[model samples]
Target: MIGMGSSRTQRPHTDRRDWDNLKSVLPFLLDFRSRAIFALSCLVLSKVATVGVPVMLKGIVDALEHKPEQVVVLPIALLLGYGLLRLLSAAFNELRDVVFARVRYRAMRRLSLRVLEHLHTQSLRFHLERKIGAISRDLERGTRSVSSLMNFMTFSIIPIMVEFLLVGIILLKEYPPIFALITFGTIAVYVWFTLRMADWRMDDRHTMNTLDSQANNQAIDSLVNYETVKYFNNEHLELARYDKTLNEWEGYAVKSQTSMSLLNFGQSAIIAVGVTIIMWVAANDVLQGQMSLGSLVMVNAFMLQLFIPLNSLGMIYRSLKYTLADMDTVFRLLDQQPEIQDLPHAPALKVAKGEIRFEQVEFGYQADRQILHGLTLTIPAGKTVAVVGQSGAGKSTLARLLYRFYDVTGGAIFIDGQDIRAVTQESLRRAIGIVPQDTVLFNETLRFNLQYGKPDATQADLEQAARMAHIAEFIAKLPDGWDTVVGERGLKLSGGEKQRVAIARAILKQPPILIFDEATSSLDSTTERAIQRTLEEVAGDHTTLIIAHRLSTIVNADQIVVLDAGRVVEQGTHPALLALKGHYAALWELQQREEQH
Candidate 1:
């Protein structure tokens, strides 16, 4: 796998960054267009009632000014109209919520699925660099923020803009043009200042999000390695580390609140000046009999409704910044190109006899540090081959390259005379099964984990695979049998038990080519002997690759290949290699001495 690029980086948003992030989600809105339109219509109707409230108040005030006899039923009518308007506003807003819930949920589901699919496409190295907690938090926060923005747009931003337009038109129609001018001008200044302040506070939002992901990663790491912490008596140290992250998050939150306080104060000050000027003019007009008393009341009510949402403009803008910061990470994850994608017209692999070959394969995880150097080897059809090498001799690289987790830098690998790169990755992987040295299980039921290999395997098939892997006896003795729950990463099971579960999974796959990467290294000698017999029986007439830790396990393999410094130093039957007294012979002798000690 190649190194990560800037496409994987989550830099903070700049101009139109929010819109750029949102573009990925535009499909959800379009898919549910009718619902979105209905919700938008509700918003408009609700605002109409909102703006109508002030007009109703003006009518009520005018009716009260009439002599009691002249306005018998008029005041009652005005009061009822005012009550209906308030109810209409509340009702329409609630209806909008109901209408848009589907769209919001669907958008979240689709976005989350895309991120998960993209993450799976990433190479193992990419995953090794990304902490599970941090990446999970990024996805969680991104999806949540995306859902929240819908509410921000419908309830806060769009409604506020609509109210502005309505209030401007009403003021121009009913009063002096200067009143409209002052109201619009004040709103414009409030929005501009709020935006500038929000942009300045974006740093705090980024810091908060970074701190949040760091804290989560620390917690996940500590908990996952709970045994290690206890063994070292580092409980206090772990707590201190977690507390430091919390303290940073607390500091950023405090700064955010303080900045919000200052912004709100400035917004209120601008609005107060605008309100005072407008009311002063209205009061003078009323005293001079140029405007009615109801007119003063109507203008005041308009100012109240307008300022209510305007006051929240700063908060909405701040939330927008936070949303962009959260989603930037998810978008960046999607932007990454898979290091080893199949060709556009790649076909499924056809494994006639599963003859595997590495012809002059050269590769490196990094450009400056090559691992495998011009290595070439072959496993004949229906034959078992053993690969033995010292650590860092590029043994594991062979398995990864065959799995197409990465493409070799030079040369090619072939199966049945067809280049592996010419085939689709999915089909190629499907034809091979591996039992790795480090077996990590999902936190699920034992039955579910076993079935993960072949979901359609019958109960009888599952039992046969388990028996062959030497795990059926242990599972049958359990209180819940196969239904027993395996804790996170199969922590409830011993290392040997987890390895057996992995063996059972691979056995269930029953692929034509099998790679046993120290498959029995974790098992006890008695169990290893029994499972080794079963493995030989299963390997009959199929290609097998074994990376052996205990040399005794591969003594009966059809052929043995010894690797040194990324090259094949020797290849022969066990007895022939023993006679040659080469690297294989020395390794066998060293292991024999260790066992004797």
Candidate 2:
């Protein structure tokens, strides 16, 4: 398991023109382009209808002013026509929302599944080195940002551009140079300020997000180890620590919100000034008979229509900045390459009889420290072999080598005349089954856990494996029997029961090679005695390797190898080693003395 060490301070950096990152998600959208294109077409039509509203108003005003006595019904009908168009536009906008939501949800699902698949192919060491909580949070944040990006692209960017073009065309056609020049100039200024504000705000938001992740991770870490807090009476201390993290998060959050408020307020003031000046100039034109009253009304309405889309653009810009920041974290995780990877053309393993051999194997987790040094061992097919060692003697590391969890730095390990490293890891592992010292079980039913090794196993097969592992009787006594939900991490089951479940899973696998890494350490003496009988019965039909701390557990082994400081010190039958009176003999003597007391 990876330790959550002191939190590292992350510097906030926003990518300029991260609109390119939007391209990374384009393929997903392209896959559903037919739907997306239809949605965008509706969006464009909605904007056209929205723009036509002000034009209709201008027409009604002109018709009523010029021919008030002729007929009032015509102008009234024009007003109702514009109202219907607005209603239709609103309906299309709502429909567009539905389409965008489907795209967002589908993209999120695809990305999350890809991340899961990549994680599955990674080596065990990668998982051991990473914080699971942090990785999960990163992926979640990325998916949400991608969804937001899709929403903005469809609803904000496209509609805003369409609105801008319509307003420009209307201004040029009605009130030539002045209206067009002022509108374009004001838009330029708005874009500049929006971009500047977005740059600063994105930086602040990134900091806030980092702080939030840290605070969340700290709280989860504390909760997961609640027992430690209670035992140490450090609940108050942990609470204070969490409170500090929360305060830091609040500090950044406040800064971000304050900046956003200032930007919005400044932009609103600018828009108010520009709109006031343009209307004032139009009113002067109307007085001089250069422009009609209806045209003035139309110019004012068009400006307001343009501002609506521009305002939406501001919100989209902000969202885009946040989406980019989130994507940065996610991309970094996806880019991480596992230290161990499969070789091209790696052949599948086929072992008829499990004959294992280690030829001068040397290994280490790091360059400076060697855990196994030139270790050599051999176990003939269908033999029961035992490895006895003190803590840190590299006994378990040897078993890991057999499964190619980490390739040996020197020499080789072979099973049935084939080098383990030369075969595909999947094939190599499938031929062997391991029952680790610390059994892990999901929060699932007894039947589900048992079937994990053999998903297609029948009820009869499950029961047979359970009986062999001495867990069927205990499982039957549960309230819901095989349907009983094992609480998180099998916390609902006792240590012995958990181990028996693990054993049953391994038994169901029925691999040709079996490894027990202190398998009975969690069980009571009676439970161990019963499991020992099961082990003996199974050993006759398979090649078994046992790493034992208890000398009595492996006393009947065909051969026992005693290791000290990463090197084998003795190899012989248990009785023969006792007679040799070496390190193994000394260990046996110590066990006898301790048991007598």
Candidate 3:
């Protein structure tokens, strides 16, 4: 709870700069520029025919008025012709929708993939500092908004603009100055009001979205710790807290909806008034012999057609505002440069003999607080080395350094005489396999989980690795065997089962070097003994480094390194370190006392 900052406490404020951010998403659309332009062109043609249909009906009416007897075939023919044109327009419209949908889906797929790739390249610290739920929510909302934005822009906004322009042109040809002035003036007023309402609602939508993310984060957190909540009988308290956040979210949502409703009502009223005034003027012109009744009918039809697109204009603007808000977070995430990035001309790591040497390495999570200070160590190939230390003694940090999770602040780490800093991260990571204390597994089948380390691993190889980890027998006893779903984060499996799965995955990877960060810390004594035997068998085949807290666990290690307060105080063979009466000896004595008790 120390770093917990309530998102609800951060009040949302709209910046006019959101429009600029929204414009930034346009480049993604521009990637398929040719297709987008073609789609828009087709949409325009369809809209023109759509607007023209009403005018054609006016022509039919006028033709009926003039002939009244001899034009039956011609009227029927014209009606059929108009119907065919409308059908063609509808087809074109459908085609445009299909093309744009493909374009939007492709763009979203590429963007999401890019974001994921970027995240994968980022350092462990970057992920540790952020909440998983928040990141997930941002990505999900951003993708959905971008897709909806593409639809709104093509199918709604652009088509509406074209319809408005066409209506103005038609009116200008018929009544010149009078029609142009009325049409342009109405549009200007409508746009002004739409922008105003959109500006007001933008902040509310942002607030609502922030609350949504918080609610999701809280829900995920509670669900993950459901057992703890039940054990403590705090389910009611958790529900109340969730309900409070939901109520806050509802408040902002209601405000946004109410504002939108008012905007819609105001827009409708303006459109009604504008159409009434235009009709009244046209009616006067017809009576005064300045315009024919047919012309007046055409103008009325065009007016009705214009309002169809105009009504959607407000909704489009509102959606555009929300899209901008969504992009703000997406761009913010995309713009973040990783704290640790590869060197421009980094080389691949040469094949290593599992010899690791850390020379005067200094490191810290923050600038003001250092963790490891001038620490130096070496582990030779094909040896089982144990790092024994109390918590926060930088034992885990040292293991992370071995994997290049964070570069040393000063000095260097070398693997097989090659500086880790000069080596490509991919190659370096591929050479090392780590089994973390808290094993994380995907919600997938056991086979998939086992093959995660080596995607192309054969079934025989998988079974062999599982057997070595002592998990094959347990897996066979399961209802679905290797095909059983592990559930989220391997929650379906016991801690010992999950640890064995992690070990099995690492074993299948067959890296030159292996790291075990208290791998058996979560297991019972019986399971630990089984895993210890497996570790001994694996040690003969690979260079293994382990962080051990239980003294008995490391008694057979080739070398035992004792650390205290981020510095190595004693290191030798287990028997030698125990005989030295140093820090290792003292810790061993304490552990033995606890075991006896």
Candidate 4:
């Protein structure tokens, strides 16, 4: 079995936690390396153009201060270059975004696919424990956060640093070292303060995310149970729950904004102080004829340009932190190892006789409670075996084990004298067909759901299967016929209708082994009897396991197995067991009395 465990990510991104996420994203970047490189090149070019803007303005100011008679055509050229520089900055940024679009979309697509694939492989317990609304909300947020984090780091954070470096170098060459020291020190302090404050705000952000997900989950849960809410008159209770979550979220929202206020005020104070010191030095230089007024204008312009990005420093950092938290959830889902997997070099299951045997099968979903205890049973080839049991007697569990949904905890299950664990799960499952008690159909047309069993079934095959399942007469009466839509979970159809659809689906599969897991439980006596007849025809010479509650449904079974607790107490033909007057006979008598009453 190959289990790809949790990876923090491939390469390190913003921090250590981002390593796993970025590692997963590295391949997408490498796949489009040329475009990434071109985009990066544009980033540098754009920053260069941006840094030159202040210099050109300085030149224009110097020329304006000089006599018009003494000025030459140089100032006019400088003005045009200044305009051109602004245009190039905007143009290069837009072009870079255009070039990198493919990389962004491809990365999101691959990661989303990987997440989805892994979620499908997870055990049923994992899905049962989590709400669908919350799970979907986290995944959606995580995928979107990937794009945001990348955009912020590349465009906002990285480009701003590059511009600051260029401005610092220019200021140093043009003035005394004290001016550069003041600007750099102020920036360093501003960054440190913003990071510390943003780190604290992360708790509030996390709380907000939790409350937001709860609110969404509650709202969706209530909506999905719309009929139940209306029947119980619980609309006020649902609204009260939803209102509570929002109110808590609102409290955190206020705290988040308040903290942001403090950060902004502190950052602005630092920048104002630095700019004032620089202006003071520049005015002294101008008075002493050591610096021109235009030089002072250029220095102030650099400060203004640099302050723009710093203003959002806390917000950007906080957003990136939250994004990584969301992505961590996705990565955690991707990292989960499926409990059951096909062994290495496992071959496809080859069914020569389709005989199924459970040898001392002991199993449970949890270790503390056992569902099946030393259960031994077998269905011979070309025969029907009925497993009759009361509620929680391991009837459904036997069906699940036969399907290999969960491996036996203490023993092995075999099909055709071959251990199921030794064969590929895909092939093992492919060789068996099951029509579960609850039939969940896609929200699609009848034709689509029918053909889902055999994707390439011919029109004649579809009609034949539908007729055999006793659903053809009903479909033909509908105006849309096969094209008629089945609502979500097939809720639009009656219970009997859904069961027939499931039976038709199984019939089309043409597997060597069939499991009818309370397949007719949802139908009325008349419809159930009709479906049972169709099932008998489909069973043919293949192995069949019928897990039924009503003894009447399995009276004709070749062999009947009576289960109590976790063990099979009796096994034989229904008549043979009745003659023996054992547990099977007693149960049969009880059912007869109930029916008479």
Report lDDT per candidate.
0.88, 0.85, 0.84, 0.85
Model 4 scores a TM of: 0.93
Cα lDDT of model 3 by residue, 1-597, tens digit? 112334434776555356666676678888889889889989988988887787777777777877778477768977987897799789889989887877899878987987898888888999887777778999998877778788888888888878877777777776769787887798889889989888877777888888888778778778888888889998887777777789999998899889989999999988988898888898998799897777888887787777877888888788877887887788777788987777898998876578888898898988998888888888888888999988888999988887888888988998889998888999999999988999989999999999999999999999999998989999999999989999999999988889999999999999989999989888889888988998888877688899988878889998988887778888899889878998888898998899889
Supply every candidate's count of residue pairs whose N, Cα or C atoms clash at under 3 angstroms: 0, 0, 0, 5
Best by lDDT: 1
Q: What are the per-residue Cα lDDT tens digits for candidate 4 across 1-597? A: 001242221212333257777676678688899998999889989999999999999998898897565467878888899999999999999998999888888878887887788787766667767787777888898888778776876778888888888988898897889888988888898889888987877777777877777778888888877878899898998888777778888988999899988888887888788778878988899899988988988988888898777777667777878888778767766777887788999999999999999999999988998999999998999899999878899999988888788889988899989999999988998999999988899999999999999999998999999999989999999999999999877888988899899999999989999999889988888888888888998897779999988899999999999899889998999889999898888888999999899
Per-residue lDDT tens digits for candidate 2, residues 22-87, read 667898898889889889988988988998998898888888888788556888889899899899
TM-score of each: 0.96, 0.95, 0.95, 0.93
Extract clashing residue pairs from model 1. none
Q: Which prediction has more favorable lDDT, 1 or 2? A: 1
The lDDT, on a scale of 0 to 1, for candidate 2 is 0.85
Off by over 4 Å in 1: 1-16
Q: After superposing candidate 3, which stretches have Cα over 4 Å from the reference?
A: 1-8, 16-27, 30-34
For model 2, state the Cα shift of residue 205 in Å. 2.0
Better of 3 and 4 by TM-score: 3
Q: Between candidates 1 and 4, which one is better according to lDDT?
A: 1
RMSD of 4: 5.0
